[model samples]
Target: MIVAAVPRFRHIVAEVWRPLAALFVWDVAVTIVYYRLPFHAPELPLTLFGTALALFLGFRSNSAYQRWWEGRTLWGAMINASRSLARAARNFLPEPHAHDLKRTIVLRQIAYANALRCQLRRQPVDAQVLRFLSHGEAEPALARTNIANGLVDGTGRRIADAVRAGWLDTIQQTQLESVLVDIANAQGGMERLKNTPLPAQYRFFPTLFTHMFCVLLPIGLVETLGFATPLGSTVAGLMFLAVLRIGDDLVDPFANTVHDVPLSAMCRTIEIDLLQAIGDSAPEPLQPVKGVLW
Candidate 1:
């Protein structure tokens, strides 16, 4: 979701400062203890442990990245499906009411995208969604727990109306419905990703090991590094902690954070595309603010 050329150091520090500071304190305290007591942790054990931790960190980051990539893929499908529907509406629908019906379908498509975005991010329906729906339509759709699904069903109903009214033929209806099905499938995939998460046990162990290793790092290095142990251990701990945080940040791509999937911007894209398709003046595409798209 972050569109910046470079990540802001202040933001990174804010998220990881607590753990980094704790590691610094622990490292310094352990180094002092080693100086006074002549007790130092074995480098062999720490080296072996760090290696194992690195492997686990790699696995964790891969899993989290998969989730992030999958979320992005689903949104890409959504974009394609919306465009397909617009094209179908433009080509298949009979005249007289084609423009009006096409416009309605396009607006509903925009609403569908917004509803999904809001649902994933756990935000209320925004002005964009309200603008697309009538008071009667908006009230009932917003009241539903699954607003996106409800809007999708509404789209189906519109297709049905178009068919019955002879705006769309049976073959044309089938084509449009196929595109709707694709949209629905993408929506369901996104909902599944939102509802589920990486297992707690999978998340718990690596964090525990990362912190434990960080706390003991200075103890392991104090004999060799002497007064430099704190600096060395703290820097190493920061590296480990940074990797762990990256995985954590990517675990939930729909959480409306800077590191999330940028659903707001994506939904805006759908709005712009669908609006322009119906010969309406489309709103400007969303631009990143301070290098963050969402």
Candidate 2:
């Protein structure tokens, strides 16, 4: 996500340049037609039209922001649950006897976080995921349609094994299982946001109305603004255009754009914490590149 206090001008311009260019051209054409041709500028209720358009854009923008925020919130929950799972695996499992097993479960928790990140973004299982899994473990998990869910299931089975081996009692197993459940719930929430989109009316109508308003703007103002029609109309139309673009930019938090939730950085955080918990060296935290955390 964009972490800069002030985003670059080029980034802002890149989002709206297409519509901005179209509005400017259309404004100029309308001004020319009014002055050179025998066209009569129609008096439009521009003030009322702009008011209604602003409300439409405002609602769409709000809905999109809610989706983006919910995605971030779900990941925050995942991070917390991952840390809890790692701590439980390290402390609950009998030391020295279950040393290797404890480490395996903790490492697999890290793998699960990375796998969920890749799954949400629809990316392939990279080294970030495979490095934490043993050859035998990776094969079956990768074969499943949902790798992250499979990894979570594996962790639960291992916890159950520890109970059978007398490394953990039934109570301790339940506690650890509860943490895994929290992680699964967080994953489900993220999947819901990624799969379900804003309704068609919300997506289509505001866009249609905003463009229609821009098209009518120059004609409505030509008689009153006269030679300044292009300047007045283009500037006015830009406000609505910018707001329209805001909704589209925030509509999908997992789209892997700069505006998306920083899933990579978040997964790295889980890796660092879990690796260090099990007495292994961890990589440095991910830093923002060009003011974007993704």
lDDT at position 130, candidate 1: 87
Off by over 4 Å in 1: 40-44, 126-128
lDDT of candidate 2 over 204-232, digit per residue (tens): 99989999999999989999999898899
lDDT of each: 0.87, 0.89
- Which whole-number lDDT from 0 to 100 does residue 86 have in model 1? 88
Off by over 4 Å in 2: none
Residue 117 miss distance in model 2 (angstroms):
1.0
